[model samples]
Target: MACGRFKELMMASLDGEISAEDRAQLESHLAECADCRRELDELSELSELVGEIELPRPSQEDMMKYWPSVYAKIERGAGWGLLVIGVVVWVAYGVFLFITDPTTGSMTKFLIALPVVGALMLLVSVIRERVNTSKTERYKEVER
Candidate 1:
């Protein structure tokens, strides 16, 4: 009954997915509503125009060259860089907080900080190595 529901039916009609009942309902609405009729016409024209468009498919060489160099390196570098920085800042802050807390014993703080610091250092080292490797391997393809 609502125009919005009728509009939905219009899309279904365009896609040839409307049932006979829905088609009759939509036609009844379209006959009485000038605005709905206009909208349906516009949607039909748009569908036709879009259907006529065809994008050329790139060759294998072009597809291979598209990524790995420009987008892949940039995306990986940025993501890794953010991860590293965030880990460092947050871990350092957590350590600083634990160290300064008066209620916690110095020994307890040391015990907790030791493993956290070790893990953080190992993580940062691995990430740095990975970033370096990625930089070097940017232009090369994986050998199968």
Candidate 2:
């Protein structure tokens, strides 16, 4: 068997979860591979040391606060979303006024529209770039 396969078996053996057939195969591999044997020894010792350690438990009060903390974060996000929507609606109304107001000359209207159009185009470009970047990063993560 290859070293990789034997290493898997070694891990199972350390956990005392290997079958008789796998144990026999692993033992034979360990006899021939001193490096694997050394690794197995180290893993065994580490597992034993870790098993002897104690972990702290969370307090009941802390556990009770967890849900409220999570809800507060979600509430904050929703509040920000509504704020952004309100600002966008207000800006759009102002832009509409600039476009439709009879008092504004054609040249003045064109100048106002120019900045709004440029800003919208820049926003769209930034959103597209971010989306493409996120997709590429997700693909790389999946490949790994």
- With a 3 Å backbone cut-off (N, CA, C), the pairs that clash in candidate 1 are none
lDDT of each: 0.90, 0.92
In order of listing, the candidates' clash counts read: 0, 0
**Model 1 ranges with Cα > 4 A deviation:** 62-144
What 10-residue stretch in candidate 1 is worst by lDDT?
135-144
Q: Which residue pairs collide, candidate 2? A: none
Best-fitting candidate, measured by lDDT?
2
* Candidate 2 lDDT by residue in tens digits, 35-135: 99999999999999999999999999999999999999999999999999999999889878877889989998888778888999999999999989987
| Regions of candidate 2 where Cα sits further than 4 Å from its true position | 107-144
